[model samples]
Target: MSKISFEGIGEVAATFACEAEVQAGQVVGLTGDGTVGPCESGGRICGVALSSEDGYAAVQIGGLCRVAKTGEEVTPGFAKLSADGTGGMKKDEAGGTEYLVLRVESDGMVIRL
Candidate 1:
């Protein structure tokens, strides 16, 4: 089989902030101080950043998204935050907080919350 990617599958939510640019494909989490960065366990996994930008970054909140996998293989089940504490998604067994895993793809898993 070949790789697959899908965009614009859900409602897009974004806001303007003073934080630095957010890169695409990176898991973004809203910080306690009202900023965005790589998600961490327990931190809110908002969605994947659309692209790198200084302000007004677009975030994909719901639906299917092609994200970068943190560790080993993943299955269709609960999605776990990255073990490295970088807010990335990993297989539930990777040692991190768990979230509902919608669908497990070869490159990443689709999360909805």
Candidate 2:
């Protein structure tokens, strides 16, 4: 699998709302139903609800459905934001990994990578 670094993203001040359109009524510390990653690697961290405000905003490190208990896939989404406001998902075919489609509506800036 292809791995991306979360540290590359700068820093963002926001919280998570624990709600996802993909998942229904299943809320966790960080909803896997939505997208989370560094805002510098080409990803946008929005609330995905009403507006891009409120809730815990996170970075889009990578995308993986099922919960990773083994820790092998325990790569949690980073919470950093880059001032450049450039971040998004990248297709890594060489790594046999497809960054799932995730759109959040938190309170983070959208950085274009």
Candidate 3:
């Protein structure tokens, strides 16, 4: 397995749409207004999923998830994908602070942001 970084609207868009631009196992760092928006269906940028089986255009934040999806889910408004020292960033302060724990696998764990 390998790790990758995805930034800006396009990369996030590709992941959200589950397009060929992205694939499983690639960690995406999302940053863009289009990557976030309000969804009447799920409220706020609650989660991400594929728009369709063959749609290139991914729904920014909460566009309207039509399919039932299951995968590693993350939401922090904006972030950068890193493969070391947990799934999130390092602490700038003296003490060690942490967020985003990396999990290898789970059958069906539910999380909220």
Best by lDDT: 1
- Model 1 compared with the native: what TM-score? 0.64
Give the alpha carbon lDDT tens digit for every residue of 11-77 in model 3: 2334343334432222223334333222222122323433433533343232212112232343432
What TM-score would each prediction reach against the true structure? Answer: 0.64, 0.20, 0.23
- Per-prediction backbone clash count: 1, 31, 0
| lDDT (0 to 1) per candidate | 0.60, 0.27, 0.28
**What lDDT score goes with residue 71 in model 3?**
26
Candidate 3 residue pairs in backbone clash:
none
- Which tens-of-lDDT digit does each residue in 25-88 have in candidate 1? 6777776454677666434466677765765557776676666566667776665655234535
Task: Arrange candidates by TM-score, descending.
Answer: 1, 3, 2
Q: Which ten residues in a row have the lowest lDDT in candidate 3?
A: 104-113
Q: Candidate 2 at residue 37, lDDT? A: 25
The sequence of per-residue lDDT tens digits that candidate 2 reaches over residues 5-86 is 3322333333344333322111122324543322332222332221222333433222222211110121223323211222
Query: Which pairs in model 1 have colliding backbones?
Result: 39-87
lDDT agreement of model 1 with the native? 0.60
Off by over 4 Å in 3: 1-19, 22-47, 53-106
